[model samples]
Target: MHSIAFRLVAEEEEGRLMAQRVERRKLRDTINPFELPQSLFEKYYRLNKPGFQYLLDVLTANTEAPKKAFAISPIAKLSACLRFLAEGGYQTGVGKDCDVSNKESCM
Candidate 1:
């Protein structure tokens, strides 16, 4: 029936939209601290990449696994946290810089 066909088409469209969203996220989350210019890294994180990685290592030395599925990378999480700190500790600002949703950055 036309109704069934229309429902299938709608579902396919939804799936395609979801795939695009996932693709965008995958692209967004590939940010790497080492790739950033040293000046920019220091300005934002208050440390160079080596220093940041050292600090991250010390901080996460005893960390446990996250209680969520598909957790963000440590570097990404640290970068977001540093961005939050640098940008007056604003969740929305950090989210914008990190290409994450405000809710995700807050969490």
Candidate 2:
């Protein structure tokens, strides 16, 4: 009985650790361009800080709301677009790099 209890506790601890790891991975996958430093932002998006903000503001201003479920934030969407342009990569490549969907990139 003691052995069984110990095994169960070990399994529970492992599950908790797995959950924490998954959460960390999700946070890492969601790249927040706004949170990046100016130099890294320029390196990735090929725009200066002010220029990026201006374009982001314009894009956000003109952005239409999604008709149904929640959508990716405007900042993330714009960052993906800029990365696509700067990298000159395929939509899927950009999507993978930005953690966006290829269909989202097309839109």
Candidate 3:
């Protein structure tokens, strides 16, 4: 009888611990309350798009006079990508499951 009661208590403790573990995992999936603003994502896309478009514009701007703007026209896309890479492009190893280096080249 005593052994049965001890086993029941142990089983209840195990069940409670399992429930806490599940709750912790759910909380882990939640976003941090002190994270960056959502507006930042909008700005990030906007900034990259314009810079990327500008780079393409210059690239296809003129086939006739490649020598004219051949050197550099003060664009932003390549620079931005390079800059982002330099500034740690898409971190993943520490905690994330995806990083830019794993999928995309810096250039």
The numbered model that scores best in lDDT is 1
RMSD of 1: 6.5
Model 1, range 1-107, lDDT digits (tens) per residue? 99999999999999999999897677556666676668866877777878788978976887886777657777778877887787777765544454333224434
Better structure of 1 and 2 per TM-score: 1
CA deviation > 4 Å runs, candidate 3: 32-107
Measured with C-alpha atoms, the lDDT of residue 80 in candidate 1 is 72
Clashing pairs in 3: none
lDDT of each: 0.71, 0.69, 0.44
lDDT of 3 at 5: 100
Whole-structure CA lDDT of model 1: 0.71
Residue-level lDDT tens digits of model 2 in 12-75: 9999999998764564446567666677667778898789889977887887876655455677
Candidates 2 and 3, the one with greater TM-score? 2
Candidate with maximal TM-score: 1
TM-score, candidate 3, is 0.32
Listed in order, each prediction's TM-score against the native is: 0.67, 0.53, 0.32
lDDT of 3 by residue, 1-107 (tens): 99999999999999999999876544333422114244542243334444545655676675343365324322323433434554466342223322212322213
Looking at candidate 2, what is the lDDT of residue 1? 100
Off by over 4 Å in 1: 66-69, 89-107
